[model samples]
Target: MNDSAAPVPIVPVILCGGSGTRLWPRSRKTRPKPFLPLVGESTLFEATLARCDAAAGFAPPVVVTGAAHLDLVEAQLNGCKGAGTIVEPEGKNTAAAIALAALRLPADAIMLVCPSDHYIADVDTFRETARKAADLAARGWLVTFGITPTGPETGFGYIRRGEAIGVASGWRVDRFVEKPDRARAQAFLDDGGYFWNGGLFAFRAGTFLEELAAHRPALAETVARAVRAGHAEGGRFHPDAQAFAAIQSESVDYAVMENTAKAAVVPASMGWSDIGNWQALHEALEKDGSGNSIAGRAELRDCSNVLVQSDGPRVSVIGASNLIVVVDGDEVLVCTPEGAQDVGKLSGASRQ
Candidate 1:
């Protein structure tokens, strides 16, 4: 990367089609965390847009969501500036989602693929890292952001950083590690040089598609056909149901990033959270004197560590600790924060 090269045009692609079953009640199929106003006054999707808007080298974002969530997506993006929305007819995973966006966008466009549901503190630092990543990505390296690990978190995957490229310590991806057990997670933290994979990527549309073709040919073919069949401008941009159904469902990590040779990790210290569960949400939010974070109308007397979100209904926790109390419109969830890993057990059994 030349020191004097002009800044590249980064087309932000927000992936907002998660079901978020673990964060049930508050986070449902139709109303996921991305649509929920959890951390701030605005929804996660809105904050994502705002971040992109504030960042340099960013063009209007291209949102890839489901056909069902079109209204919600539009609603969250209401006050914010306009951007393109590509609705999928079915859930074909991140590979299809990104492919659709890359196809709809121009060939030479530098795309920053991000999840809409993530919580990223320190937007300025994020923007600076993104600008640097954009510069590297323009030179043909598929750049991925690796969040500085705060602790031995078993819930999130790890990216093993390898070899320095420049002043940025551009590391070759040693491997993409899965969510570890506590002992393994602690080992990873102790070993150092490992960062939590935040799933944010920066790359050129054409180059990414080329790598996709080389690695997962079937996926590339299917996505290519789907994009070819997608509705054009001034028309519906949703993928064909039959075509999308024919494609296999897989994440971008498994589909391309993990397999590509040119993959690199940008080690960053940005505070990020996937907000995978309610406990994670509680940890992310601000707490009171008693280490309690209450939303809506709630009160806590002797609660040491607890989170409550109600809908104007008075909730009083006198002696609760390390608990999550969430009251959605039709349902309420009260569970110990430690049991949050199996938080989806109820929903899974209910489906059965």
Candidate 2:
């Protein structure tokens, strides 16, 4: 479908709620990885704004984030060319979060929902894939981007592909597979019919709500109230928090996509990374001969395949291998790379 002939209004929804507990000390409740200047001078949020494809009818993205980060979210987007910002009263997960945006957008518009904290080095490929997804979405199909898995990654969920909808095109979601263990992940790599679930989705507004209402009525009803109550000004919506909180917390995957039959995955390689934890960050960052990555200000000696960051005085690491070290004002995090996923649990325990 020529986008010019029959244009699809694409609205970008940026989900920016995760605590970044795995990267704690630097990524905190008040400031998460999305807000932190990780990759460069610009925060991840700003990079996401820069990545929007306005020519493809993608309007300024609507950022779905917690109220606490409202100030940060607005600040990052303030100078951005084409981006909108909205805050949720609480973290109600993706289903309610997305519903709020869909309700506020034009009924005829299609949306491309993205997470704010991810890192994509190849912006061109990302934008191109998004445009393709938008084309599919315009055709009344709920489209999702499926990352071509490079290796056995236990960190991400997997999607099984079905009969093709086009040549190198739409694929029916065989099922939403859970994050597998190392053995299962390796098998998925060897089997060759699986792709990493990137979480990016494109679909029509009314169609999504229709499916949500039919499959997950409770969630649909609750989100509907919030979406209806939401007020939009220049494409930004301020939903009623009290009402939104009434909705149960759930991910879009669970509330709709998993249940709906129209779900399709657009298999593409966009160099995607959720950056959920330090290990993921380490994997995504550029590495040196010693296999060590340094962010902020740090010095490493005899380190291999390790990540270290310092926000204070010049830091030094010696004889550390496959570890993560982060130093912030009052917090210091050091852990083995394999155990980095447990950092969230450790941080939660420390709070107690």
Candidate 3:
């Protein structure tokens, strides 16, 4: 990147879609994971907003969320001045959500598409990295933040680095790997050429829309129509319900990046985590020498890497490792680390 190049205007596009079923009892459809204080005192959604503040040379953020969660969205965005919310009639996955925000902003605006519920420990590094991504996006490349892998994590997709582009370790994407088996993930870690697909993205609105129209013509047109028929009041913009519902669900990765010749990746090691499940959340919180972290009421003896969380009742654990115990309302969850991945499949996770 040319240090002398002028900076482009960046508008953060926050996608708040999933109900976060993996978090189970604590996360519900009405009160999703993004709104919950999973990582720290402030909710994840709030942290996301602060990370891309206009003070950091960003324009007001455009948040795309479902209508059912409007109250939570409004509540969290209360103190954020100039932030705009694009209300979707229903959840349509990342592609449509991003398209909605892209179409709503000025064509030249650089849209920083960020998931509302991810955790980043180092805010400064994230801001700096985001700026770098913006620089790439302004140059007509679709950019994604490539998180330095801490381990052979099977939960995330991986991006293979191609030839270097721009400056400071940016790469033309060679290929995207789906969540691989343990052996493949280990091989990727050993190769030292793959980065976890962190889901953060950057691109010019016009460029993204053009690519989406070319690759996902039908979805692109319907989203454009939804935006055209949409109405805005104050900070909230509501897309046409019928039009939005008519659009087929798709993710931005499949709809554009995978097919576009402009794909690029930026490597970053800024202490990021999805905080996706109890086990993952346990890793983020402060832990004792025994490798145990407790919230609310809990007790552990001879335990290693055990997470105990309760909304009310006290719990006790002895002689256990890699265990998760959670109590929320009428539901209580107990499982091993491996079992954590399937928490979303439980009957309680789907309850409204």
lDDT of all predictions = 0.83, 0.81, 0.90
RMSD over all Cα atoms, model 2 = 2.5
How far does residue 317 in candidate 1 sit from its true spot (Å)? Answer: 1.1
- lDDT string, candidate 1, 1-352, tens digits: 3344455688899998877788887777767779988897988888898889934547888888887798898887775454888888888888888998888877778899999999988888888888778877877778999899989998899999888767654777889999999999999999998999898999889888988889888988888787777665543387766777789888899989999988888877877888888888888899988789989898788779899999767888888788889887768788888888787878642342
lDDT value, candidate 1, whole model: 0.83
Query: lDDT of candidate 3?
Result: 0.90
Instruction: For residues 1-352, write the lDDT of model 3, one tens digit per residue.
Output: 2344456788999998788999988999889889999877999999999898878888888899988888898899976878889999998889999999988888889999999999999999999899888888888889999999999999999999999884544889999999998899999999999999999999989999999999999999999999899899888999999988899999999999999999999988999999888888988888999889999888888999999999999999999999999999889999998999999999888774
The estimated TM-scores of all candidates read 0.94, 0.92, 0.97
> What shift in Å separates residue 61 of candidate 1 from its native position after superposition?
0.6
- Best-to-worst order by TM-score is 3, 1, 2
Best by TM-score: 3
Give the Cα-based TM-score of candidate 3 against the true structure.
0.97
C-alpha displacement of 163 in model 2, angstroms?
Answer: 0.5
Which regions of candidate 1 fall more than 4 Å away from where they truly are?
1-6, 54-57, 79-82, 233-236, 348-352
Candidate 1 vs candidate 3, TM-score winner: 3
